[model samples]
Target: MRRRNQVRQSVAVSAALLAALFVLPLLVVAPFRTALFGRETPVDETEGQPFVSGQLDGESALRVLDGETVLEMDLGEYLLGVVRAEMPASFHPEALKAQAVAARTYTLYKLQTGGNHGDAADICTNPTCCQAYIGEERARANWGENAGAYEKKIEEAVAGTDGQVILYGGVPILAVFHSSSAGLTRAAGEVW
Candidate 1:
């Protein structure tokens, strides 16, 4: 009977140690996650106000590299194209709005960081390099019968979230996003 009791205690202790091995890291890391990843600033701190970083204001023109040519266009116009290309027009308006904010924040971050193209432009049209973009004509051609409705939908999404951006530490974050995750997504730290 005493031997059975000792075995039960040993099993309990081993189970506890095994559990601790998994739980302890989460407990220790949870409190520091925000500190390590940076937290979003409170909305009250910046509510109703457009984020202006350095000389990059909401109305500032953006220089984009489309193929070998450089084109300068309004920030809103650029985001319209980015939203049209980066996300499907069939998505919900709210989702498109979120994408707009992320794309805007990313564009601002690139501008602040001196983007990959250096001197050539603030951003590029390549999805791999920066973000994908499709002009109104291309988007219309692709939409076919849904052109008018899709255009209106995309325009509303872009215009509705105009000047809004996701900010961290009072600055725009990189705001990377993907269209699909291939059934599973990995944490940023795991990939980077």
Candidate 2:
């Protein structure tokens, strides 16, 4: 009788220890979920999945405002769209290359400085605000027969200068450009 009681007690102790091994961790960790994992930002699931473009390639993504909608795309692909919208495809390749670098720099600068489009967007399509962005369909419609060639040119310019950005004081600089400036560029303080 004494031996049977000892065995039963041993079994009870083992079972309690096993249960604590699983339950205790969950109990201790549940309260810290918000602190450790970040608060969930509300998403507009009604809008469906956001549009994605280009090769993706595991690069960091940017959230852009496409008119009323928010679009997410890879950095290089975003630059391609910017270069297409901001510069003429008929321009010399070197000119396009310069524009690509400037656009990329400007984008990086905005990202680092915290974008103005609230937390929902990193940039917008307004030329007056962030930068102009030409969607693939609009660009195709505008270019007509030359759409294929023009798109390829822009892709080359972006790919050739991958990861390049303008820096001032070892940080990315806001490199801005305009359409057909009549005079040499003026300081921001002088103009704005």
Candidate 3:
């Protein structure tokens, strides 16, 4: 009986040590992880309040995924690229304005929500995953003769609607746009 009790106590101690080995690392790293890749917080009840500072400014940078590389660029510059890539510059100015608002809102929403890219980026260039973006050089190549004019137009759209985002229940809406939904809206359950 004495030998059995010793074995059982040793087993319990070993089990506890093994559990600590696994759990201690998690406890130590969790705070750092949260700090590195932001924590999600409930939206404030305040409505139409200006969002803190995820906007296009001298200090702001957006992480963009181009192929396997991630580049950080000025937020305003990034918005110009997104608008040009996502919308036809030939579209009406109001349409461009609406798209700009959506893009800004979407980016801000991602920043607030801890992002979907495994917490690596605030937004991405993949239209399927996040938003579509084209660098200035590519936009020029794609536009040819219209490059300068189209770039200016898109810039204006972004500037005109700067920091504006549509909110539902005090949170930025998903702000997703599709060219055509085959004459039917996608069921929410289907996409999410």
Candidate 4:
């Protein structure tokens, strides 16, 4: 009986030590992980007022290149396509709004700096080159039954922050964004 009790206690201690080996690393890293990748609270500048359209009424149209063709479209209309393609419509309205602003700012920056396509167009539909774009028909097809609702959400997002752009030193900033990062965020100079 004494030998059996000693074996049981030794087994229990071994089990506990194995559990700690697995759990301790998680406990130590959790705080650092949260600090590195915490969610940022977005600021609401609209003061809870409902979004009103027509804010982009007087803006110049955008010249977008689609493959071999150059298409002219209203700035807001183009942003609708960009936002829809760049972000999931299921995202929160505020997130969609932020995407719209970022797309608009990026477009404006490209215009000011003379885009890589030379005189062909202001921007391209290819996401690798510029922002992604999806026509209403294609977007609706992709959304299937949720087409109308999703399009309406994207439209509201674009119209809600119409004409808004991120600026630095009184000029529109690049406002670049990516869906994911490789462990750490890299600066423009580092990537470019």
Q: Estimate, for each residue in 3-67, the C-alpha lDDT of model 2 and write its tens digit.
A: 99999999999999999999999999899978888864443223323333334322758898988
Local distance difference test, per candidate? Answer: 0.83, 0.80, 0.75, 0.83
lDDT of 3 by residue, 1-192 (tens): 999999999999999999999999999989899676786443332323322323444356777776788888766667777888888988988899898888878887887887877656667888888888887666766777676677667767877776777999999888878766687896789988
Which residue pairs in model 2 clash with each other?
A: none
The C-alpha local distance difference test score for the whole of candidate 2 amounts to 0.80
Give candidate 3 misplaced runs (Cα > 4 Å).
1-59, 187-191
Per-candidate TM-scores read 0.69, 0.68, 0.64, 0.69
Candidate 1 per-residue C-alpha lDDT over 1-192 given as tens digits, one digit per residue, 9 for 90 to 100: 999999999999999999999999999999999897896433232222332222233467889999999998878888888999999999998999899889989999999999999888989999999999998777776777677777777777777877888889999998999999889999899989
Instruction: Give one clash count per candidate, in the order shown.
Output: 0, 0, 0, 0
- Write out the backbone clash pairs for model 4: none
Residue 93 local lDDT, model 3: 83
Runs off by more than 4 Å, candidate 2: 1-58
> Poorest 10 consecutive residues of model 1 by lDDT?
45-54
lDDT of 3 at 182: 83
Query: How do the residues 20-56 of candidate 4 rate in per-residue lDDT, one tens digit apiece?
Result: 9999999998889967678643433332333234556
Task: Give the top-scoring candidate (lDDT).
Answer: 4
Winner on lDDT (3 vs 4) = 4
